[model samples]
Target: MIELLTPNEMQLADRLTIDSGIDGYALMQRAGEAVSQTIVAQWPDTKIVAVLCGTGSNGGDGYITARLLKVAGYQVTCFTAGRSAPQSYSERAQRDYVADEGVIMPLETFKADEFQLIIDALLGTGLTRNVEGKIAACIDEVNSCNKPVCAIDLPSGVSGKSGQPMGIAVKADLTVTFFRKKPGHVLQPGRALCGVIRLCDIGIEAEVLEQIKPILFESWPNLWGALLPDHNPDSNKFRRGHVAVFCGNVWSTGAARLSATGAARSGAGLVTVVAPENALTVLASHLTSIMIEPLGNDTEKLDTDVLSFFKRRKVKAAVLGPGFGDQERAKRLVYTVLQSKTEDSDLKTLVLDADAITAFKDHPLVLFAAIEKSGLQLVITPHEGEFQRLFGNFVKGKDKVEQAREAARLSHSIVIYKGADTVIAAPDGRAVINGNGNVLLATAGSGDVLTGIIASFCAQGMPVFAAACAAVWMHAETAECFEELSPAGMMAEDISQMLLKVWARLREMATPSPSPST
Candidate 1:
């Protein structure tokens, strides 16, 4: 789990390092040198370079870079947006650059086409508001120039915390950041702007995270590998876990079938689909390994069948809502599933997806209350539209991470905001951003497969947040692996078959490679 810091959190870390006796000026010098070295290494032939500086410390780094680049025999044009106050770091840096025979000009004098390379130090991670006036103009010019851009820390105008642009942002060919990555470097529009991210280790130590106690993370196998369940010779079918998937309708049983197949492939010892009475024969014919259970058409009948299944089978996890055409019936089943109890343990897990999420849009608060009262470990998978329907636009302008975090807090469940950059947020403020997904996962019934994989993990008793992160990574990565073998398009069923290779790959990744010996 690579830690991703918010802007405020990074600020605290810097302050702590300074308070503990590290020189702030020394830190700034190392930062500048990193940027300068990267620029020189990536473009050694380029003789002309433009360093765009602003009023803040980001500009201070730019001043130092200009001085270093001058010493390195490069033709440097240094531009400052505003005058630095006297006796400050920015002023000190400017004076040092001038003493080294490096000339500083106003930002208005900057010419985009005059230089072969551009250095963006106008704004750093601290930017909260939109770029305006001269700074905005400089950014616009830099972007329009189409010159090779090297950004210090982050591109100007992109939010370090949420990754959203503040009016406009610099599109950099290379971005040199320090210590660790901010959310902006990995999150979407900002991610697209930062073409290639280079993490340069300055003087700041990663140990400071202990004091910072960051809750956000970038998902990787290390985050959940230790918590994953493994089967041994003594394990039995019932001992591994039992997963139950609810069917949509006779005409639309494919979605549930995809989910059930996914669960079975994910190491769920027993996978079953609870189907409508009319769809039992269809589901049975299609499914060989997965079992089938007949569900009643009405609310009372569904409640009875659902409770009976739990009582007899000791089901560990249940999935609902994929391809469910009737919203009202889906909502009723969700409520019934919430009220379900199992004798296997004190707690039962439930996953809601697609139609199930939309069914609660009219009165989301009621659904939240029911989940809370039932004491079920709940996870809700909602795309942007389903999220808007259930959570409204109160979080309209915030980035995907913040919106998902808020939704988790409100619903008292782990919120999986499904997207190309999927965000998994736990109720306690812990969050993970999944970066492995692609357009290949945009096909029909893809999310249904994801729902089953998550259920399988929960059934196996993997921790909730860890289960969600693992499930999301597996779902996207399986698609990527499938494309390598069958580059032609893939279907929802194909993903389930690919899960075997993905699981083996995960186990390989989790295993430590043997060290070379004498």
Candidate 2:
């Protein structure tokens, strides 16, 4: 269920299901039944419904749903735009619905205000180009009506591969997708358009995944929760992991403090804020449980001081950027972390965010070369603006997931492309589309909190990809938990404070209970 299939992959799944002795029409029936059941369960009082059908299998699902609803005594109307002559499984569904005396109306005859609910089965996941002509008009008509829409598979004009809208798209109140969800269901305009997604099991066996080998997955704990470091009773502070966070100047220290607290709360053994001498007082005043080390004021000495601190403190992971200003010093610090290694130990991992990402806008190749030289386990978190500043030209036409994967491959690092639907991609082309985030994460300093969380995981010996995915999922979970407390009043600090609660919940879920005495 965590695997996200592309539209083509879904088509292959359908073909595979059909080849396995299950009739296509039978699958359509099951899909229709699931959709109808969901609608009835969610809106039991609805008496009138409109089912919009196309000439494809999606229309077949609508026709079957219409027939079932008619049989149930609800006033169901089937509206067809260009589906006068349905093809293949759709034709069969149309024939059976006609045999049952179901009402089929032309698109012109259908009025949006006349129905309590609208079932949009006009386009499935096969769409590639922008929607146009009569289909576009029908989408416009549905959108203009403001009626509650339940889309089949996907909203009509949404690209199944990318979440972007093609020309125009239906805004669905609920989207019922068969089997697994497509990337469009989770990835921005499409995710927003699909208000509430209901994934229905329509008889597609899980074994098909062996052949498909889908690399994309939904960002959830089930995908990476088991990879989290287990708490051992015998382990001491140093065994957990140590994270060093670089603080900004005196006036801009809040972001670093937020990151330090986040690391401390997210199970890091020790959290230290490596601050400039000018910023030490501000950082020390705000930080209680976390420790702070003061580096000299000279920017030229910053790199040497950081390298020395890493070796002396045996820092397992370091988080750079956050509130650090976009300066040459930031670039130097990144290069130093990337190149710093001792006879006894090397800097194994780092989380680069905010200013660190922005600092390499003109010299990304230099940063990439440094990564190659050191073979650092790196996680780079960048929002759209920061991403545009760094890899915008490289990822111009590609979708978000592809952009992240390509970036990860090019830099030989894990890329956490932050947004409402964050896409975490690894160098090997594996990706995860995060669905746990909400608008509450829109606040400032949220990304800093995320950086610390990821750094903590990396410090604790999680694989780079799993650490990035776990951090993104937990960050979103914190935002969700914050929403439960005050939906609109959430600050970035709330996310850091709530990390322990989220970790407790995840640990409880991962822990096994004693079996019953059978």
Candidate 3:
């Protein structure tokens, strides 16, 4: 897993290098030269460049980049915010460079649009406060210019740890950070402002990532490759795992059937849909590979019968949600499903989504209590509206990732905050931001597909934390495959077919590259 450093942690890395006998000034030069190289590559025809310098080491980086950009035949204009020079070694080098040949323009005298590309070096990772006074005005000017801006290290006023904009921040066209990326580069607002990201290595040891130990990760196939279940040559149907799903009424049975198909397609050995007796005929006619079980029509009868059926079949895992109505009957059904237990063991896994999450809107504590009492794995998938109904209004204006993390901690369950950028958070502090999914997944029944995938992963003996992350990544990757296909007319079944394609691609990456046949 890659590490994303906070501002202070990144400073620790610099201190570590200085302690190892490398001169701080030499490190600054390398960083600045690398930034200069990036500028030329991106803007080869540009003859004018403006570098905004601050009062510290970030200013030093600006001076050096200015000198290097000047050497490459661009007219470089350097601007400084404070009067006194910084005391650091790198700062002294930057001051000396300006004294020799660079044109130091006062902040008030500099005009916007004088340069085609603005390089914002006003603040780096060291900044902890909001932008104010002349600095705020300068950032405002940059924002009003409408020209492309490249930020060094991080955007001028965004927090590296939280991705929050401090008062105001420089919205950059591209943000060139060193080594591994930071949270701000991926989190919202900051992520939206940072048009594109480029990570540069300036002699920082790759091993430094181990010491950082970031709790959040950018989700990719590499992270979930090994978590997928292995299908052995001798594997039997029972050995692979079975997932049982509860269907709603006749009109609402499609969701349950879709989920069963999704589970079956996602590698579940067997998927059974328990439908109300009235809906069994229609469901049976619709499903070929999935088995259909008859459920009693009345809530009390169904509740009593479900437990017996689950125990008799020795079902490995169960999915209860989807189109299950948000009424009292649905609530009773959900409670009965949660209470289902075996003679020798507890129900190890349960997935809740759709109307199931909505049913517990006024009494979220009941959901929490259920989790505490069961000592079983509980996974909740909620969209923004459902999230508000179930978890209350925990998120005010915070980014979705932060909101999801907080929800995961509060509920003490794996929280799948579903959206274009799905964030899955475990109670154990691990979180992932999925980048693979596109708007094509915004269609109806897509989430039901995801619900089935997670249920399948849990049935296959994968831990809830890993299963949640792997399932989310796979769901998103599947949607990305059909990016060109509009989500407008598509149904849930399309995503199940796409899952097979996603599985093939992921499996290829997991397997070792083939060698030539003898």
Which runs in model 1 stand beyond 4 Å of their true positions? Answer: 342-347, 393-398, 483-488, 510-518
Which of the two candidates, 2 or 3, achieves a greater lDDT against the reference?
2
lDDT tens digits, residues 377-402, model 2? 88989999998888887888999999
Clashing pairs in 1: none
The CA root-mean-square deviation of candidate 1, after full C-alpha superposition on the true structure, stands at 3.7
lDDT by residue for model 3 (219-254), tens: 765666665688789998777788988888888887
**What do the candidate models score in CA lDDT, each in turn?**
0.87, 0.86, 0.78
TM-scores for all candidates?
Answer: 0.94, 0.95, 0.89
Worst 10 residues of 2 by lDDT: 509-518
C-alpha positional error of residue 183 in candidate 3 after TM-score superposition, expressed in Å: 1.3
Instruction: List where candidate 3 sits over 4 angstroms from the true fold.
Output: 83-85, 125-130, 341-347, 393-402, 484-492, 508-518
